[model samples]
Each structure stands twice: as C-alpha cells, then as structure tokens.
Target: MHIHKKLVSLITLSLVLLNTTACSQRIGALNDTLKLAFIGDKDVKLSTQQVNDIPYASIYAQIGDMSQVFIVLVFAEPKVSLTQVPTTLSTELKWLSADKGMIVTVNGRLVRTHNNPTGDLVAVESTEPDPIMLGLQLASTPKTWTRIIDWQPGYHFGYRATSYFNLVGQEKILINDIPTQALHYSETVLVDDLNIQYQNEFWLTPETGNVIKSRQKIAPNLPFIDISLLKPFAS
Candidate 1:
C-alpha cells in the first residue's frame, strides 16, 4: 500500500508539470499571433467627419509612381490639437489654433519632420525629423546645397541618417487647377555599406515655402513615395 501511494503521488506531479508547460506554450503562441496581426495591418482609415473636424490638410503618398498602394498624410487625432493662435494675425479671420502645436502623420502614424523655418508648419514631436521643415528650407534658403539628418520609422526599429539636398530651380506648375509658383529641389541619400543611392524630388510653394508636391524615398528597400497636396485646410 505504501508503494502504491508513492507511485500515485509521482504521477500527479508529472501531470502538473506537463499542464504548466502546455499553458506556457499556449501563451507564447498567442503573443506571437497578436504581433503578426499588428504588423500585417498597414492601412489606417479616418472618417470624413474626423478629417473635417480637425485642423489638418490632406496629402496622398503613392508608392513607386506605379503600385496601387497609397498612404494618407495627416495629423493623428486627439493627441494633437490646433488650439493656440497667433496674436498678431487678423482678428476678422479665425485660424486653426496652434496653441497645442501640430504634428505630421503618415498613414495616421507619426513619422519624422524636416521643419522649414520660414514655413507655417512646426514640429511639436521631437522624436522624428520634420519633412515640411526640410521643404521650407529648400524653398527659402539662398544656398544651392544643404545637408539634413532624416529619420525613417520601421516596424521594430527606425534609423536616422544624413541626406543632401540641392536646389534644382523654380517653376510654375498647375496643381489642383491652380497655377502655383514652386521651388524645385532634389535630394540624394547614400547608404554606404549597401552602396545604394536614393534620389528624391520636391516642389515647394514659393510664397509660404511649403511643400506642394514631392517624391521622397524613406528607405532603400521601399519604393519612392510621391506626395501631392490635395487641398489646404480651410479654417
């Protein structure tokens, strides 16, 4: 009877260990499944009411100038606000509040910005470089060449690297049925170890030095992203 009782206790312990291991494996598999689901979802869709309610402009980013994939650029909701106003501006016209400041979002996700010192757009988030600033810099600066540190976001990790920009010239282009004066420029990024050179183009409004259209390459593995300003936000 003593030996039988000892055998029964041993079997019970073995079953407990097996059940614990199985539960751990199941939890790990669940975690992996969640990660994959998050990674696979790339599109972020906002309702028309949401877009109209916010003080934001809409721009479309096309991949490679060929692929059907398109990404929308706008400010992320709730986290960003346009509450502050410029004191010296005309009292008759109400503008979007800039008190809370603004942020640039790509596909509803925050990317880096290239702040143009002369332009109206400003970077509130410090983690990413501002592309709008870069566009304004290219438009306003008299110098023919300049360099910038650009940040590219990724799935798990992002990278920042030096990129060079050159002012190509100025031209009048008809965008959205309007004849607009724009400053043309080109950007070149060199990936040293990869020996890959990526080229991008930009057209900024000459008056405000804001980016009107652009062909930007954020990563060597990704296609060139073309952005066109659909319309400016109406206050």
Candidate 2:
C-alpha cells in the first residue's frame, strides 16, 4: 500500500494487525477488529475489564505524544511473537502496526526496529547478558554493560555504548486502572562515539521479574518510546 494510504488506514481504524497460529491467513475485517481510539491523549485510561475482553495479547505504545495499542501480529513481514530466542537469554516481542511499522524488543528492551519514520534501529549487540534479563533485585547493587548498536537510512552502524542499571526501590503503579506494586529501575546509556546519552526506565513485577512498563530510546535521534503491557502474551 502507498505510504499515504497506509497512514490514512491506520488513523481511521486505530487498530494493529492480528495474529493467530496460522501465519498465512488474513485477519477479519478491519471494522470488526477492536479499535485503539486514544492515540495522543495522555489523560486517557483503560479499565481492566475493557482490556480483559480483548482476545489477543496487546500493548500500549507511545512514541512522543502519540499512543496506540499494537497486537502480536505474527503475519508481519519479520514474523514473531512472545517466544524464546534459541541459545540466548533474551525473549523477543515483535510489535507491528497495520502499516508494517515494527518494534522488536528483547526482555522488554528495544533491540531492533523497522519502518520507523525517524530511521530504524537496525540492530543491538551485547557481549554480556543484559541486566534486565537477569532480573532486578532489591538488594542488587548498581550494574553496568556495553552494546554495539546499528541504525539505518544513513547506514550508521557499530556504535559502542555503555549502560548503568540501578534499582530505585519498590513503587505502586497503575495499569489499566488497577493499582499494583512493581520494582522500578533506572538505566542510563552513554554513547561516546555518537556523543549521545539518554535515560531509560523499567517497571517490573516484583515476583516474576516481568516488565510491565518501560520508556526507552534505542538511538540518539529516535523518539523515546513508552510501552505498557495491556494483555500479557505469557501465561
């Protein structure tokens, strides 16, 4: 579809693509799909009952001021869902829109992205396990790690970066208007080569160590993306 038409479709429907066991079949009609009506309204809130009625796993994603609910569309060009990556500690979650815009995350961290208007984060590599995958603990001290990141549209690649993770204590947060307690952690990433530095935050379930919400900036030029799990793909 043309870029302009795709944008119109997205704005009109406000729904992400769909996913099922079979990756080849087209989903139901767009009008029948559940709509994500609140795009850029920060004051918008959803009830737990409203989220529970949705049959598919979903997430609330905000890039800059616009927010939308994206589903796990396995039929996406790259094709993936909540699954373990073989020989790796990271599990991948691929969020794609009707327009084929994709955001690939591992252990709730933005690792790769495609079809982003501000240029995509092509890849992220790390020699050591990410602190997020290790699970942040209350008694844990500050930790640091490094990564090699790549970007596209300008063929920017192999930029070295460092990140520091520090526990900020337990806090109460609301998801879908339901109050819950979570462990909060702060991360600071510094990319000397690109002369860039940014802060990322994560709120995880204290018992399971699963990330419930996060705000991350994968690259210097990219907008800080905020994600909140509305319907968990995991059992």
Candidate 3:
C-alpha cells in the first residue's frame, strides 16, 4: 500500500481548523472522501460527524499524501484498531490500514511501522522512560533524551538519536467542535550517525495530558505520519 509520493505538508495542515464556521465546512468537505475510503482510496478524508456516528473510537491518519479514518477493533494490551487513535498516557496503540499496513505508537510516539510506502520502522527503544510518558510534566520546561531506532529495507539498526522538547504554551484547540485549551510542544530529533534530523509536535490535553494530535516521522527518510484522535475511549 504505497501512498502517492506527493506530500501534503503536515505543518500546513496544523492550521486547517481554527474553531470557526469555515473550519467546520472545510472539515465536512475534506471528509467527503469517506465514500471512497473503504475501497482503499488515497488521500482519503474523514469528518467528526463520521467519527460520532461510528460505534468505535476513531482516528484521522495521514501518511505521505494519503489520509483515512481508522477505528478501534481490538481493545486490550497494546490496544489494536483497524487504523486509529490513542486513549491514554503511556499507552501503546496499534493502527492497521485498509491494506493491513500497521503503525504502532507508544505514548503517542511512533515506535514501529510495517508495510509502509518507502520502508518500515522496525522498532524504537530506550532504557529510560520516554519524555512523552511524563505528559504534563514535560511541559514545565525544556528537556532532552536519547533513544535507539531500527528500520527495514536497508537493514538499518541501532541508530541513536537525541530528542529535545520545549513547551510552546497553551492554546485554544478545537476537535470535533469541542473547544479546549491544550499544551503545545515542539520536538527536534537528531540522529548523528545517519546525519538525520526531524521535527515532531504534539498537542496534549491540559488535564489528562493525553496527546490529541501529533505529527511524527518514523525514520530518517520516511514521510511524517499525522495522527489525530477523533473519538476517544472512556478513561
């Protein structure tokens, strides 16, 4: 299931909704692709209405130039979904695409990926707790950490990377027309061995610190994947 190489800058998409009427209309228009999503269409889209109408929790996922709505199908250890969202802090989420591609995340961080377009992320590991698991604590100040990552297609393994995080302050955010103030944080990751550097961002709820939205890169060259919780499970 290789997606089109054409990229839709996730940064630009971050500004897609601004808690306004126009934003709602735009969202509805974007999700008009739902009719085609089931057929494995590329660049698929989803609406908050679609999420609400569904019985299961859902997520809006985008990789490369394709986007789709995935739902929770299995809720257990390492919660699984046929493409989806995360429910709580320090939780592992496994999302499966229409064609059976899998993306797994821990604490809202990309941990592994399989059957991706360009390649796959074999795994990401760290001896210490990932800063994200700390949730709201990470927002108090800037911090840094390190981790080792492995990838497939080229047998790349054991590449270490350092990540620096800085709080970008609280801001008004709207999801599914519900308004809330969320903490924004910026993350920069550098892998000196591969001469690779990438940026990731997260928006966490002020209270529970659950990541409601994020833009993350799985490997050095793989395009960033965007995941946004459209419907969350009860805590």
Candidate 4:
C-alpha cells in the first residue's frame, strides 16, 4: 500500500511540473510578440548627422527640365526639427542665418517668424511675414482654399505680400510602384501693383500624409525646387 501511494504522489508531482513548464513557455511567447509590436509601432526621429555613414534625411531635387538632381541634407535641432504630435507634425525651418526661421504648428498654421540681425539667437523677435510658410501651408492643406502670406527673404528683410491657393485637381500616380495621390495647385501673389504666379505640386501618401515628391517655386530668380523624399533615409 505504501508503494502504491508513492507512485500516485510521483505522478501528481510530474503533472504539476509539466503544467508549470507549459505556462512559462506560453508567457514567454506572449512577451516576445508584445516586444515586436512595440518596435513596429514606435515613431522615429532622425537628424542630418550620419549614422554608420548613412544620413538620416536626404532630399533630392531636380530643377525644371534638368536631368541632374541636387541633394539637400535635412538636419534636426530647435532650428529644423519636425516634432510629431498626436494629430500632426510641427515643423520649424531655420535659414542659413541662425536668427531667422519660420515655425509652423501641427495643423500647418504659420504661427510666427523671428529675426535677430543683432547676431544674438536668444534675442529673436517676431518681426515680419514669411513666404516659405506659405509654401508649407499649401503643401499641408491641399483640399482647402487657403489664403497665404507670401514673402521672399532679402538682405535685411523679406518682401511680404498676400497670396491665394487654388487647387487644380488630384491625380493618381505611382512612386516606386506604390500608388500615391497628388495635388496640383497654383498660387497668385499680389505685390504692389504686380502679380506673381507660382505652380506647386505635392505627391503624398493618402494614409500617412507623407510627402513623397514636391515642386515649389520660391522666387523667380531661385531655381524652381523639386524635392523627392529619399527612401531608406527619410523617417
């Protein structure tokens, strides 16, 4: 009778051990899947500084009818960082001048422009309107008719004016076989008694609002800039 009792006890112990091992394996599998999901859904922010000899952001542009592509490196800082918010991304573009830049809100609203010709970055003051902000607004709000403040940077200041955006239409296009949507718009700026015209186009991913390609005319003298977001480097 003692031998039979010992046998029953051994079987119960073995079953408990087996069940514990299976539960541990299942928990480990659950943890592994959760880790993968977190990695895939995390947002990424990058700068112009190279990582393993690869730049974080690279933009390629080709002027009108030009076969050669011009490259622009995008950097990140308080100056030029695009911060991801719950709804949209807030962008700030600082010109070569440390004191001059434009800030756009998450909803693509041009909040302000600052200048510190005194060479003090900390002493920047919101002084005038910005034309670059107008271009950005056009890129962000393609479906809405928006009025933009137009200006061109000059030696000491920027030429300021008002402009209106008119949407041409939307067309289906393919970038690297990824079907995309594009919006074409024309802008008319009124300065003094003269009117300046610009044509803007933006190719974007409909789901993410990521701009794949863009063509913008900042000034008549400056080259009409065409920008294509470089794959593998664009975050």
Per TM-score, the best of the predicted structures is: 2
Per-residue lDDT, model 3, residue 138, is 46
Please list the C-alpha lDDT of all candidates, in the order they appear: 0.42, 0.68, 0.64, 0.36
Tell me the tens digit of each residue's lDDT in model 4 across 20-48.
Answer: 34344443333332232222212222222
Put the candidates in lDDT order, highest first.
Answer: 2, 3, 1, 4
- TM-score for candidate 1: 0.45
Write down the RMSD of all candidates, one decimal each.
Answer: 18.5, 5.2, 10.2, 20.5
Residue by residue across 104-216, what tens digits does model 2's lDDT show? 77667888888777778887776566677777763463388787888877778888889988889899998767788999999989999878889999999998777889999
Q: Give TM-scores for every candidate, taking all chains together and pairing residue i with residue i.
A: 0.45, 0.77, 0.73, 0.42
Off by over 4 Å in 4: 1-55, 64-67, 70-74, 79-89, 92-156, 232-235
User: For candidate 3, lDDT tens digit of each residue in 1-235?
Assistant: 2333111222122232222123344444433333335435445555567657644445667776665545332232444332222332345666544455667766567888877876899977666556777664544533787888888788799998899988888888777667877889889999998788899989988787788888888788778888877777543
Arranged by TM-score, best first: 2, 3, 1, 4
Worst 10 residues of 3 by lDDT: 5-14
Q: Which stretches of candidate 2 lie over 4 Å from their true place?
A: 1-19, 22-33, 36-46, 73-87, 138-142
Q: Cα deviation in Å at residue 34, candidate 4?
A: 38
Itemize residue pairs with steric clashes in candidate 3.
Answer: 83-96
The positional error of residue 49 in candidate 3, measured at the CA in angstroms, is: 3.4
Which 10-residue window in model 1 sums to the lowest lDDT? 90-99
